[model samples]
Target: MTTTKFLTDEHLSGRVFDGGWTTVASVSDVTEPATGKAIGKVGMTDAAGIAGAAAAARKAQKGWAAAKPDDRAAVFPKAVAAGYEYWDEIVEWIMRESGSVRAKAEFELTLSLKAIQIAGAMPYEAQGLVLPSETGRTSLAKRRPLGVVGVIAPFNFPLYLAMRAVAPALAVGNAVVLKPDPRTTICGGFVIARLFELAGLPAGVLHVLAGRGDAGEALCSDDNIAMIQFTGSTNAGRMVGQNASKHLKKVSLELGGKNSLIILDDADMELALKNAAWGVYLHQGQICMSAGRVLVHKSIIEEFSARLAEKAKALPVGDPMSGTVALGPLINQQQLDHAKSVIEQSVAQGATLLAGGTTDGLFLAPTVLRDVTPAMSAYNEEVFGPVAVLVPFETDDEAVQLANDTEYGLSAAVVSKDVARAIALGERLNCGLLHINDQTVNDDVVNPFGGVGASGNGTSIGGPANWDLFTEWQWMTIKGTPPAYPF
Candidate 1:
């Protein structure tokens, strides 16, 4: 497939923008991970630019907060319409810039649209509670916006992750300054700005600054930013949380995961195989909820491992734009190197390589390893690639222990013929999201999406959870007459 000019100057005109876009002196070339070509360039925002963005957001938040709930709810559907109008172009940018296959890109688009639609209704939800009062005074508790919010989104699933925060924050009357991953500035930053601009959002309510960690640090430490919502690796999340804490700001961190899929001896092989393959191989297993470990009962471990190896070997790996393939390239060379190191280190630690430990440049073949123990890197850490590690357990207790062994508690799944047993096992796993007879990589717009421990900071996004994540509570009282008091 030949690449055409999908992203034009209109999209790449600037990186840091409050109401109107502005170009910066220092710009970086946005490269396509699959082809290693400079697709476009984005202006790099420095500390000054980040500070300007924060000031703008803080200034604009008052008006936005004063807007009627219905008026605030109206912008999202328009944004959703704009998103569909430019659907193909947006999906292309996602595929080229983030190395997502067509299906994954489309899935992201669908979820992003749903996120916008769902967030539109958030403003209408009950914002306060009327409480019984003493001394004939009216008592009430209300939710209020947290002024300016800083959202830092990752390269993988950039559109969805950014929208999930941006839409809800804006809907709840908070201004947002978004810092998209520099690697995916176009799809994550530019697209969002364009959508909101088309939706006729108020000036300075949304700001996009596409830069590196320095820019993120400024956003977190800025006094004007009241809260920070970050979705990235655990290492980066830790830094963001620490910085936000220093400034005494509220921070929500959705970090990395080393999730697992548990298959019992009585599990349906066909169903387990399908779920296992999809859990680990989808989007090259770059998802935070991607199943990094596959725990199988000792009675069925050999058969399950062999069938899974065959499935992995058969998956097509190539440039997503060039052909219909099951897997696409890694985001960049750094990701490729890390994935390779994980596989090699796991094999050295006595794990058997059943299929694939090879890479064709950025495209890594879907790999499978058997007899993987807790000590192996593949089992302990998140590979963030299309690699599945199979471990055998003799009992349900052992399976639960293996699944809960990791620090990450993002997502997990259990498969068994007995629904009761699967649910029981799933409840014991130390993950925020669990699936019975399903893959770990599943989500809905209405679900409370977050994790525990290293996976997140015990805060969730979406549904009613968004209200709490983006807003603060205030107690109020109204009295017709002043009460007698001694001063």
Candidate 2:
């Protein structure tokens, strides 16, 4: 294992830490000797390790929940301080471990800092309310935090998405036990746990366990876990939510999305093509909200596809550390295989591959598909890879229909130079977030971010809504005035 300093204030230089890559399991390490790339091994955690963390959280949550909101907020400002201290190394390791290029990795670190700041400044919103009653005496509404939150994260955007739940889960006074993606385990939990310690948090307030899905499931099914915050595939999400239902616990799932990008006839042609290309290919398109389906106006379908093809062909592909490489490998061999299989099946069903669609090692080329239909699996299913299927539509109504065709409705986009047209399309698209003339405008802080249907419910973010997600509300009223209206 190799421990590195991701970030910390100068005073806590020795305090900040990340576990070196530890070999937890697997027959042999997946490696490409030619390029020196290592696909990580599967990892596990014993039942005792899980039970120990759960016990610590249950004990810590009791006092943390009773502590004032301001007391909780105090830890966050220091986390932000740590962000600035280790910004460079944070981005550097992100690029190396997750295979994300420098630009995207840098952006993720900056956004994480912003989220920490937003979560720390949420005390005013956490306080309960006193209400005026029609009867006579006092009426009150109280908000109570759930005890412990088990955060199970996926590999993509490892830090960015994990922190989304981490901030609010802790800010609302709940203890946290995080189970990071086995693929990106050490980067999220080990790195993040050290920062919490540097922020002056209690030892048991946050526990990092490096393990696979089974370890996480154990935590979720335990009687002590008050909530489960999950981000992953639709199939796994269903099982997680089902288990949490048995215990009647709260949950937040930011699952898969077959998100669409609608290019209206009025779009800024040059701008739309560039932005869409960036959104579909960045981080090898492992992002859930990444635009996988393109709805093009019939009037400009051919023209836009040609332009998109040219832009995609220009993206350089190589190792992430190369700095000049436009695209990087997927996290492991499994994802690379899945991306290839999806493309091959789509091609067999008559979709034409436009720019790039082939795999080498863990690298899948940026690809574009023409003449796609909703009946195809790629149309409705979330393809967490660098692939896009362009469908032509005669009008705005047809475009909206295509965008809403998927069971997953996490995000969507509208590209148009006309402000009114873009706004209209944004309003009509049934998604948690909408982008207008932009590839992606993902702000990870200060908002209630979540979706419906297979995407799951309960927002885990900073804002008034953030507080409500982690806590339940109950109303109280005096009985004196009730007799006045009694029948």
293 Cα displacement, candidate 2 (Å): 0.4
Candidate 1 Cα errors over 4 Å, as ranges: 1-7
How does residue 87 of candidate 1 score in lDDT? Answer: 86
In Å, residue 267's CA in model 2 sits off its true spot by 1.1
Model 1 lDDT tens row, 1-487 = 2144435676575445678777788888999988899988888998888999899899999999999988999999999998888888889889999999999999999999899999999888999999987877999999999999999999989999999999999999999999999999888888888889889999999998888889999998998999999999999999999999999999999999999999999999989999999999999989999999999999998999999999999999998899799999999999989999999999999999999889988999999999899888998989999999999999999999999998899999999889998998888889999999898998897989999999999999988799999999999999998978998
Candidate 2 shows a clash count of 1
Against the true structure, candidate 2 has what lDDT? 0.75
* TM-score of every candidate: 0.97, 0.89
CA lDDT of every candidate: 0.91, 0.75
TM for candidate 1 is 0.97
Error of 1 at 74 (Å): 1.4
